[model samples]
Target chain A: MAGHSAGTEIERLIQLLSRLPGLGPRSARRAALQLLGKKETLMRPLADALQDAADHVLTCTTCGNLDTTDPCSICADGRRDKGVICVVEQVADLWALERAGANSGQYHVLGGTLSALDGVGPDDLNISGLVTRVSGSDVREVVLALNATVDGQATAHYITDQLEGSGANVSQVAHGVPVGGELDYLDDGTLAAAMKARRPF
Target chain B: MAGHSAGTEIERLIQLLSRLPGLGPRSARRAALQLLGKKETLMRPLADALQDAADHVLTCTTCGNLDTTDPCSICADGRRDKGVICVVEQVADLWALERAGANSGQYHVLGGTLSALDGVGPDDLNISGLVTRVSGSDVREVVLALNATVDGQATAHYITDQLEGSGANVSQVAHGVPVGGELDYLDDGTLAAAMKARRPF
Candidate 1:
């Protein structure tokens, strides 16, 4: 259905808005009209904010985290333990980890995991940047905090191969029943892994 | 669990984005990060589009539909039946009707229905403009095509009361079971209304 007869400008806004991750064509129009309805309070500020973010935000040189600075706030912060680097698949994953207060160490955002099906090789990710950071630093440990997907495992194995001679020890996050998870809903693979890694009470 | 440490610009974008319909805190962050990651292809274009719309689009004094011109394209179109005006609650509803090719008549956007709880009354809507249009022209019918909600019906009734002596006929959209809808899922009120309004089909 042609739901785009408002005007060229509004239609254009809707088209662009639909490209946003969580928005579809229908919700985009709703958002566009809402913005137009509250032009001074919403539309103008959103436009300005988008432009400002586009211009200021940059990828960190040390880590792959996104911020308004070159090295990013986390990388530049002296309080974080630079000797223990926590690796993540994406900047969002890094943010999730940080929000959980999971680690006091610095982060290394991989940008993406390797996937042969998608033709995303090691070069496509921030692997070289990660290797360089680990090689130069006095890193005691390099934590591989990747997801449990096949691509994540493949990428982790590749990274381990790349850092074979590096001084830092590599370790992956433990797999088990989640903190609030029910035993009845536990999958076979998780049950086996958690059982294997069981410690004495 | 503060998940907004990307920087002020990203944080601000997330805050603004969350305000849009169909978006919440988590989804807004995902959208903001997506925009940042594709600045040239997505972010820049969206920013430009929003600015262009804000600068060019204006509310049509003739009908209340937002457009780049004083008289909206729909209202200015000579092909449409100006004698028959379809009155709707909002510009979005007008667009929906136009897309469906439901009516070839002109439209008058009321902006909203009367909501006594929220203090919305006839004066809050574009009722006087509608009255003036009906009075001045040889308009055969003024279709009160508002939604089927309590407020919508109340507003329609109020407008009918206001246009008592006007020459033009006043009518509302038909209320019945929606096409392709199941009988089991139909509400009692709608079923009764549809049965009452049943015609020789």
Candidate 2:
């Protein structure tokens, strides 16, 4: 009689799942069902991966990004150009640019941008570390890929100001407006061409 | 001049992020970037919540739903009918049934169906527990709300077989196919009407 206690296992899964972003009690429950339905493929592996990551992953010492090791693979890569650094607000932006196959330069993750109203300051970002990175003798250009929002712009300015004495040529992603981004949701060609036609701010 | 070190944080984030469901390296980076752009609101809370949930949550014992408590709110509800158990393959199905707002009976999560190719057996499904639940007194009807997939059907039959001698009537959700679920993507009115005219399996 106690053998049919499916609810007990499910309860454990639901609790872990409900905590995911965009999932409330309802969606979390639904997701749990979906995961349970594919127990062999989805459930156990997900649990294992989560636990593994939680246990093994650590923030890169050189950068603020998450990593299983300290220096991170990219930072340890000697083949990459240490001279030019692409500054981005989040780690995702660096991947996007890489996917575009546009820039081969090294990268700096700012972690997040400067926001005055919400009380985020310079220390919260990776500004100081970035400034130190720019000081290395071989470094050259610094491309800024921060978003175009108010906070994004402010963060951009803060980075530019910090890089003043470093002598690195700073730039932002060109192409007026983004494709698939509102202005709204433009064509790739338009975005690409805009990047090609960017002017100084 | 050293300030920004590109590829440090971004690469680490991608490695960590690529592990999420529906996200490869590309999408994870995109999500991380989006979070960076909205750090104060979306980013911080998301991180805090994830950490909090990871640290605090445990599985519920009674209904198989996730909660901070063992029984979960639904299982603890004495007002719900213990006699009529609505069986579903996942937590999602249970939530969907709840969303439909008609069924007020207690729930039993199957966790998954019997899939031979995937090496899933009855012991894997938490089904044996359902048999025990039915044998207990006061049980009346058991509603099966499985999907219309081949595996779903096979699981339903298996469940019906288990309940054969339990003296309880068993039924499946009837009416239109799901709206977003597509036959393909039916209208709300059609879906609502389908529930009204659901037939016996």
Candidate 3:
């Protein structure tokens, strides 16, 4: 398939594009053609953007977030509550929380959840950094904004144990029916959790 | 959503990626993070590929196919049958045909189909170039391998009209129930076309 491509450069572009999360080989070729057709408007700009991101974007030392700044914009923002830190599985989760305006606190990206089959441990993650942040600072609460998966729960529990003596209170986000989520379509576990964690109107 | 991003470079990358055919804003962000996470392996190579494509790729002067060479690889290929030319609406279509190994002939990309609503006319397409190729070369047949859309058929008819004096056989690819397609799931128009164009059992 690659050999039949118009040019090696274009083929290489498609190959690299297919490596992206949502794109496959077929769609990658389509994307390559689209980029070729709109060279100035889409292709060049995307090229410039990718190059720029490659050159500038860095991991935030403070919160393990990807940013241009060493501490990241969230960590640098003085307006955000310094006393609260939202723990998440990845930078995307951090961005999701920010997009939702769900919290006015800082974020701590754990990179990924603890996976036993994958052999990911506390050392593999940014757990020590998170513990140091909670222990060194006057942080009042460390909120686990991790997903409701088994690995996510296990990771949260591990972090909670690590932050046991750190003065900061460890709390997990609630597991229940999502906003606008239908009860009928939801899983039995979610329905059961929602029932048990029912709040007063 | 853009404003809440960690860095401007990452934000711009996400924005550019979201403009690709299949990706939305959310997936674009996820792609950006994936790129950031695997900077050396994925991000840098993709950037290099894009820049290389931008710097090198050129449209084939003869058939409107995109390649680093002006004539394109297919047009330059001595092994391919120059006697037949497959006409397609876009370079992607040409790639698809090549991927399928559907033909051993040369190709002529039309860039896009004729669209009255979009104000796409003959002047906007490579119809004249195709005519010139057929008239000048020993081309025996010009195959219209366009989509089944109304715009595609309109473009094919328009091209057929323009090739009146070119002395080349103008034929369109057959439209029928696709291979492995079930009659129960096939649309009415496709079923009707399949029935009308029934071949020897």
Candidate 4:
């Protein structure tokens, strides 16, 4: 495998594919083989798609969403509720929320959380843009849909502090036992949060 | 996600990535986000590598191995023992054997096994080319390093029959307990095979 018996081009393809988030070396090799086996059907189209994305996909100036347009489809759409903006850590989280259909409002991507260990500060993220979007606008509610991680909470708190008197009500997505999640398999923190947040049903 | 919130190019990239062997829709989205995040470093290089592979990689005429050249580096090399030909089902198997340093001899890729149910026949494989290479040559042995599956063995038997009286000894890789296999977790058929093929050590 090191000597690349399949040739340099195939080896390079496998190496690049292995760098993807979920693909390992073995699966990358298999993927390369499949691509080579069906060049016209899979490989060519995939190459074209990658090229197209690289050339066209851009970050939205308003929401920080990745799209072919500057404002993105979500920002450009008139049907979405502009008054309530769901703030997420990344475009992936926004896509997840959209897929789940949990929000009918607009979205604001922060790019990433404030990570001190990695030397990632507020300036490294799109926090300033979010504050600017929230201030002097029709946006009445800003929902923090960030992850439950420490950095995510810290970033949310920082954003909340930044939007203190912007005349927009700040809120956070509920943190409790996930729907359909087994309590036996849940962590102590989640169990405590679920207990504390219990409502009168 | 269905409406291509990230735009058509990003959605197309994710769709193509999901079609790969090991990636599903969720992982594809993650991979696409990673690519978008690192457009210059990862996405562009991957696109270039894939395009290069699609344009240059050709099927080796001698052994059916994928390579940039016709005869392939293996066939072109003068140091390899041409007298012993290791036959495998596909280029992947040939690569596996090469990676393990299992064979110093030449190779013959059969493309695929003889699958009657799938309507694959002898003519569909590169069996005739292997026979032609073995006949009227100084070849001493033809090793069938095919899978231990039913179709693989059937193809091996058919090849053994076809290569009869061709001045070459036909053999198959042994099937038994793997080198690092545990006895307790061994299957009945494997344990039986190991017992039947016991050596006087």
Best candidate, lDDT-wise?
A: 4
The stretch of ten residues in a row with the least summed lDDT in candidate 2 chain B is B1-10
Per-residue lDDT tens digits of candidate 3, residues A1-201?
455757888888988999898999988988888888888999889888888998998888999888898888889998999999999998888888888899899999998999999999999999999988989789999999999999999999999999998999998899999999999999999999999999999
lDDT (Cα, tens digit) per residue for candidate 4, span B1-201 = 334577878888889999998899999999999998899999999999888999999999988888999999999889999999999998889889989989999999998999999999999999999999999999999999999889999999999999999999999999898999999999998899899989999
Q: lDDT per residue, candidate 4, A1-201, as tens digits?
A: 435577888988999999998899889989999999899999989988998999999988999888888888898888999999999998889988888889889999888899999999999998888889889998999999999999999999999999999999999999999999999999999999999999999
Q: Is the docking of candidate 2 incorrect, acceptable, medium or high quality?
A: incorrect
Global fold similarity of model 4 (TM-score) = 0.96
Q: Give DockQ for candidates 1 onward, in order.
A: 0.71, 0.12, 0.72, 0.75
Q: How does model 1 fare in lDDT?
A: 0.89
In candidate 4, position A168 carries an lDDT of 97
Model 4's alpha-carbon lDDT is 0.91
Question: What is the full ranking by DockQ, best candidate first?
Answer: 4, 3, 1, 2
lDDT score at residue A5, model 4, on the 0-100 scale: 72
Clashes of each: 0, 39, 0, 0
The regions of model 3 sitting more than 4 angstroms off are A2-5
Predictions: Cα RMSD each? 1.7, 8.3, 1.8, 1.6
Which regions of candidate 2 deviate over 4 angstroms?
A1-12, A177-201, B1-201
